[model samples]
Target: MNTPFPAIASSSEVRLPTGHHWLYGDLVLPESFSGLVLFAHGSGSGRHSARNRQVAQRLQQRGIATLLFDLLTVEEEHVDLQTREHRFDIPLLTRRMQDATLWAQSQPQLQHARIGYFGASTGSAAALIAAARLGSRISAVVSRGGRPDLAGPVALAAVTAPTLLIVGGADDVVLDLNEQALRVMQCEKELAVVPGATHLFEEPGTLEQVSALAGDWFAAHLSMEHAA
Candidate 1:
């Protein structure tokens, strides 16, 4: 039986508030979509990053839509990389994610879809903070080798979305932080450690495991029709 869905590679972009632009990504949508999974890349990686693209492709293949946007404008990225200040601006990035979520909700292609978030590294912190602020607007969240601890106690406690945290077994420091943060999260959450995977999950096959875990988590949580 042929699955009613689009293949990987199709993607686009949209302009957000303040002239910021977002790469509206993923393989194209089938007639109907289960939900939208927006990607929040790590501190150094942007939307076009190969690792993130691979994960997004995997999600898109599973009938999910994904958006990988450059959180900071090019100019901002340059400055942030130079000064390293804006990269840790979790509050600002959270607000931007919130703005992007609202913008996504208004789009014709995604208007009726439940929204989910996929965040990595510091971006995970921003995603959690944004979920806390947006409340029921977001249905699910997944963090890959993330630093959700950076979101702070208030945001961690306030998040209500079902969340999945995928960490590297070999990355001891981040794993500890993720464990500690998990205790603070009042939402439905789980932590999975990929054996032999490092902080980047750059080890062969590790990223695939992360992607599969993320896809399953999002599908189970976001596919449900609920009032938000």
Candidate 2:
């Protein structure tokens, strides 16, 4: 399932305008792309998130472009690191992600591409909220070790995009959280557990499994959106 996407190109330090300021990100585009997925890295993570980057690379191989960006500005991140604030602010993150999504949609390379969301950790909450509010603008969603529960029942119930929640088998608490979130969601959804893997999916082959599942899900839904 992992095949090359033709004419791959990337911008490592893209600056996205958020009205208030600019946030940094990396945008990877492949020729004749099927769709674009925006990564919402977990709290404390940014554009350089290794796990997210791996997933993005795998998606690109399957003809999906990806945008990995900082959810917070540099100053905000510095304060968050010291005060442990802003990371769990789901609304704040949601707004920034929305801006990033709109920004990505407006870019020349991504203009005609369907959009999807790939969320990790608390970022999943923001992604769900953004997806719910944006309606058909987001074609699909996938959560890796994410806390979709934090998005709250109202937001979960409103999401229309097909969502897949992936959790590590060994991460009992988060697995349970995803299960509960799944029940509240009204849209097409699924929960996938990676056997013997932990929260970070550091175990060998676990991340690959995650990547494969994500690529397949996006390829199906995003492709359908493009077709429609």
Candidate 3:
């Protein structure tokens, strides 16, 4: 796991109720926040994902709040670890993302903030679907080495929020998939290819580049000065 970033203005543990389950998460806020970015990690990963947290930290540094939550319950995660059943359930994950956003909107501390999504791997599909369903509620979206094609063409066409799809140049299959999704998407979008990076972006400086790109994208779209 990557070492966590420096302390922020406020950081706390939150529990979001999704009718049948309570998903746990980490919420980090800066002193004077501009917007909130929700994180959706891939299958077999959750709020504790090092890469996601690193990106979240960068957002916080830019005065953007962040929420990194688990998409599955402990029991479901254990079952998925054994059976790989719920990992690919895009609809289920999409509902979870929607529920989490509603939960954030209901909170006194976060209700007034604009919302965005930062998704990695399969979680990108869930984020895109949720963004499409939420319409103008979502201000921006950023995907890192994600399978956005799993979101399907309809959702891609329906997304109105500006999006940035970041892929590792060495990840040929996913890069092509991102290109296809970009073509289907009618919203403002861009595909960023980080040279020499792989699927996980474990290479030195690659993850940092992802963080920088995501921070800039969210800063541009999630600003309070802009309409959501």
* Top of the candidates by lDDT: 3
lDDT per residue (tens digit) for residues 61-85 in model 2:
8888889999999999999999979
After superposition of all CA atoms, the RMSD between model 2 and the true structure is: 1.6
Per residue, candidate 3 scores C-alpha lDDT tens digits across 13-90 of 999999878999999988778899999999899899988989888888888999999999999999999999999999
Candidate 2 ranges with C-alpha deviation above 4 Å: 1-5, 224-226
| Model 2 quality (TM-score) | 0.95
Q: How far is candidate 3 from the true structure (C-alpha RMSD, Å)?
A: 3.5
RMSD of each: 2.6, 1.6, 3.5
- What's the distance in Å from true for residue 180, model 2? 0.6
Q: Can you give the TM-score per candidate against the true fold?
A: 0.91, 0.95, 0.96
Model 1, 153-205: lDDT tens per residue? 88899999999999999999999999999999999999999999999999999
Q: Which pairs clash (backbone N, Cα, C closer than 3 Å) in model 1?
A: none
- TM-score for candidate 1: 0.91
lDDT, each prediction? 0.85, 0.92, 0.94
